[model samples]
Structures are given as C-alpha cells and as structure tokens.
Target: MTEPVPPRLLLVECPGLEAPDEDDGGLHLRRFGRVVEALSSVCPWVDAVRPGVCTLPIKGPTRYFGTEEAVLVRVAEAVGEALGPFREGGRDGEGDVGSGDFRLGVAEGVFAAVLAARAGAVVPAGETARFLAPWPVAVLSDPELVEVLVRLGLSTLGGFAQVPAADVLARFGTRGIRAHRLARGLDGELSGYRVSGMGARLVAALGHALALQDLQPGFWGGTSAADERAGEVLTALQRRLGTEAVTVPVLEGGRGPADRCRLVTWSPVVARSSPASSPGSSSAPGRERKGSRRKASQAPLEPPWPGRLPPPAPARVTVGERPVEVLDRSGVPVGVTARGLLTAEPERLSVDGGLWVPVVAWSAPWPVEERWWSTARRRAARLQVLTADGVARLLVTERRRWRVEATYD
Candidate 1:
C-alpha cells in the first residue's frame, strides 16, 4: 500500500469578526470575499467554507515562497492590506474599513489546520497526530459523539483515537468513524490525505481558474432586522420540533375567503423578498422594464365571474368543529328559504355558546351555489350583520342551519 500523503493544508482565519446582523446587509460576506481575493494573490488554491474561515493548499505556495513560514507571513500581509486600516472597538459603521488579527495554521489536513489556526500555532509536516492529541473531542462539532466519548472517559482526542476503528464505526456509524479518524489526525474524505501530489496539482489549477472568475465585482444588499429575527426564531422552533412545525400564511387565487388563502412551509429567503416585490415584477438585477404596470393592466383579461363577492373582505375567519348559532325572536333557529332569503330576520347570534348578542342591522342575503352537478352540492346564503356591540359578521345559512363564516375587525 502507498504511504499516506503528508498534509500540506493552510487555514487562515480572521479573529474578532462577528457574523453581521442580517440587517447590516451583506457586509460580512463582502469583507470575507475581499479577504479571499487577497489570499488568492498568495495561494490561488483557496476554499472559503464560511465568511471568516478559509483554507489553502500550501505545497505549491511553499515551494514558490521557499518556506512554509514565509507563505504564512505572506498570507498575513495580504489579509492586512486587503482589510486596510485597523478600527478600534471593532467594526463600527457601514463603509468603514476595519482590520483584525489574521491567524494562519499549517498542518497535514483540514481538521488539524483548523485546530492549529485557533491556537495560532503551526504543526510541522507529519506531526499532526501529536499536535492534535491533547485537544478536546468537542472540536469535531458532533455533540452526540463528544457526549458518548466523554461518558466513556475518553474526553481528549488522543484518548478517543486509542479506540479500535471498527468498534467506533460499529458504535457511531460513518460520522463517528469520521470523528475518530480526525482525532487520529486522519482528516477523512475531504482532506489532503486522500489526494496524491498529482491530484493536488490538478485541483490547484482548477481552483485558480475559479478564483479568477470570482474576482468580478458583485452587488450587495441589506436585509430587514425583523425578517432576520423572525427567521432565527422559526429556525430554532423547527430545530426543537420537526421542520413541519413552522408554517407561513400565503394568499392564493380564489373568490372564497377560505379558498383564497393557504398555509405553506416557512422559507426565510422567500419571505424576505415577498414583502418588498410584487408578483410578476422583475426582481432580477437590471431586468426591470419601465411602464410595465400599464402593459400588465392592458393585457387581455379573463371573462369576469358575475357571482364574485364585492369588496371589503373579512379580516378574520375561523372554520373548524366549533359552531355558532343564529336565532329568531321566538328562540327558534333562523333558516334560509328556498328563494335564498332568511325565513325570519336574524334577531340574535351566539358564537360557541357564548353570551347572546342582539343584531342591530343586516344586509340582504346573497346566494352562492357550488358543485351544482355533483351529489356533494352545497348551497349557502350569506348575510352581513352588525351586532349591538359593534362587531360585523358574515353569517352563512346552508341546509336550513346558520353559522358564523367570518368577521370584520
């Protein structure tokens, strides 16, 4: 078997950089992109896993610069130059340039590089296992695996790595085996250990091409604080319950109140854009057409439905097992005649057997017939009434029974 490739990874991190509040715009990504661009000048083979954390293959850069330490110093200088002047008290306002300590780590694999970067140290070639031995298993970011290891009295990477690989695989599956490997300084699938020197050269060439393409300037935009907070809360709630726990109210195309609206899975990105842009509008950059409103309205329209309800839709509507009662003066139930009229005008109403409310005013009943050709045909007459307490309700009568269909706030 061929010997494992010696790790040649370089991890670069910007210390004291906080994730920007979504409201602060894309400032975080922009700054991170700038850093990536700067580091590309030193080593074109760069991968930005997140805003502040980045990795690079150091073999080619080290050969070019004559030493691994020289490459690290060059990367630090590039990051500082890209970040510009240092601002005291951290990043303050929009458009203000700030600088932070740039930590560089060089080791055999990605995981070892990350650990070294955090400690501001460099692990020499082939010494990754010794360097990572004393670190905690929590660095793997797998809470369950860490907990299991701690319970087994294996808290440090060295202790956990002592376990048999087959046993770890049997106990924890693929993820557990991966953690075990990382603890042993074997960074698993994505690390340089899996790639030969020839493969690294090819990957470096492809990365360089991609970096050049990404150097093009891009526009940035801000996000709403309310939308950001709402997304965070929804994400947390989904994590506790299942993803199906959170839903959003969406308006659909229909005449009936119930048919016009629906509940859908919540999406933060979609929700953020929905409130600001209109349907069919050009949301893409530089694609907006001027005077599109007139063009849209002037387009051929569908034949109008004569039975459509007039303006002033109800603000609230409740539909479920609970029923409301509408009664006449004699305490008898109010019924709708075959001619789509109330037999005895509504005199009182009660919701869910609550206190009776006297009707102050009412409008003429409007009939709505649905599924006329089917056995499940439904016929209802709706009446808008004002109660003595000044509440407006839309009451419907179907099969000689009355129910509160909706209400105006």
Candidate 2:
C-alpha cells in the first residue's frame, strides 16, 4: 500500500450488477444495500456510489485495521458475507447472483479508484498517473473523444494526459478538459455517473413510505401564518446546506409503492400544495405537466393503480429489506410457484432471523407481472399474513425468497 494522495478512496465494484435496467426487479439494488450496510461496520461513512458500487475514504479504516491491504480484505469479506445465500445456483441457476464477484481497489480519488477496482490493483501513492497510463482511451467512456484521440495518434490515457491543458481545452471544450484532468489523476468524480437520490429510491423500492411535512398553526398566535415563514426557513437551509438538504416524499400514480413514491427537493412551491389534493386539482407545482388533461375526448381519468393493496394499507413500510424465512409445517422453506401460488402452506413466520411465530390466516397472493416486454420487466407477488399473536404483515417475494415488506397495526 503506497502512501495515499490528498484523499485516498477505496472502491468496491461487483461486476454484472452495474446495469440499471437489469430485469431482476431491484433484487440487485437490495443486495447492494445489504453490502453497503455491511461495509458500514468497517467505516460509518461508506458511500453507495451507485448500483453494484460503493466507496469509502480509507483513512479511518486503515488506521483501525492497521493497513490498506487489511482494509481491502475486510471490505471484501463483508461484501461476500452480505451476499452469501444468493451466490450459487441462485435466481438464474447460473453460478451468478447479486455481488457474486466483488472487486476492490484503492487510489487517490473515485475515477482512478474505479479503474483500480476493475483491474484489481491498488494505485500506488502519487503514482496514479503512471498506473492509468497504459489503459486505452475507451475507458474514458466518451466515444467521440476516443475517436478524435485515436485519429490524433494519442490512443492511451498517458498520451492524452501529456497534451497541454490549454490545447486540450481549446480543442474539446470543457468536457475534454475534465477528461484530461481525470487522465492526469487530478479529479475524483465525473458528472452523470451518479444517479441523484439513488439511495433513497433504493430504500423506497423496498416499501418505505415517508409522509410530507404538513404546516401547522402557530401555538401562541391565532392562525399564525407560518406557511410563508416555513418556506423562508426551508429556502435558507437549502441555500446554506445545498438543495438536497431538505426533501419531501411525494406519492404519485403507479402500480406499486416503489413506483408511486420518491423524494424530491423541498421548495416553496411544493410546500404550498395540499397533500390531500386529488385528481382534477390544479396540477402539482414544480413538475412539468406532460399529459395534464386530455382534449375533450381524453379526460384526465384518475389512475386506477390496478392491483394496488386495498384500503387498510400497511401502517408502516419497512425502511430496509428484512430477510425472513417462511417455513411450512414440515419445517422446510416455503416457495412460490410459476402460477404465483405457494408451494406449501406457510405454518410459521420469522422476521430477520427472529423467533418463529405460528401463522394463522393469509390472503391470496397478488401476483404482478409488469412491463413484460421491456428489459425492465418485473415479476413478483405480495401476500398479507396474520400470526397467532394477532399481528398482520405484508410479505413480498421475488425469485422464491420471502421478505417482510410492511407491517399493519
């Protein structure tokens, strides 16, 4: 482990899990979440860089673990443990599953760290430039620039880095300037690689439903006009701490909870709208109205949300994925079949390796097969089950694994 540059970053990348449009219906995202959680034990500041990828500053972990090599090994072990059960003969019957093969590497910043992860090599301290030299321009991910560089006889990062900064900028504009910095190991992150609010979206995909804050009347004064004050305060906070400082959860029309809700930055406009406002209400502010109201023939009909859970919806949606082992009377794991029917009656329920409780009653599975023709196609099912303790829960399963999705009071 060579000395680190200004700030050393350790990157963990799991091949085959980077595609956002994979057809696993978010199983990959949830597994990545688990990997992130596991890495948190090593360092609290672990960052989920993107799907199938995460990074953490190596300073703290190295100090605690004694060496950068040790930290890398520890991180690898943590990810492996988190994704254990799904490694072999998994959902696809191929020896491939979520984070099945994780690669780890350390470098001064994110751009180099990612390359190091792919090559499974740690960039020596202050030697990032030399380490990145041999890689072809294709790794830059800019096809046009790669074409230009090849024609110009500068086909490698080292060659590109040798170009005078002024010349690169004048020829390629700001984009080329940034790429040159990356090639020179002067920049850490690239724009457009990170998906905004991806962590929140991942959590929301698992059934977390957050409510937007509602304005309340002032205590001392009679109907204190706090709406305006609230907006001012939120605006100030955003300006100080950045726009992502304040966010409000909004539920929209979709087939499932994940599709229906997301966190959007809070703004005065968002605060002014009524949460109870239903369809036909003046459209919500901020968001563009693409298909607001159809012409005379195409009225804006209320979204059916077909197959959505009936009223008495779960009181709380779990924030994280809770792995549960549903067992039948024979003590074998219960599974769902192709027809969306259970292989055996569920006789007991256990939440996150908890004590098993007797299952009393259950509802018919609500099978869902959405977007069947697209790469984003998903197939899963949900069922409501009651335990002998009189508690009810919503359980969802994809690829024959059961998890607690939500709980009812």
In terms of TM-score, the best-performing candidate is: 2
Tens digits of per-residue lDDT, candidate 1, 324-373, equal 68888999888766655577877998987999999999866666665545
Give the range of the ten consecutive residues with the poorest summed lDDT in model 2.
209-218
What is candidate 1's CA lDDT for residue 61?
Answer: 78
User: In lDDT terms, how accurate is model 2?
Assistant: 0.73
Q: lDDT tens digits, residues 131-162, model 2?
A: 88998988888999999999999999999999
Off by over 4 Å in 1: 1-6, 86-99, 188-409
TM-scores for every candidate against the unseen true structure: 0.44, 0.49
Question: In candidate 1, which residue pairs get closer than 3 Å at backbone N, Cα or C atoms, i.e. clash?
Answer: 7-108
> So what's the TM-score on candidate 2?
0.49
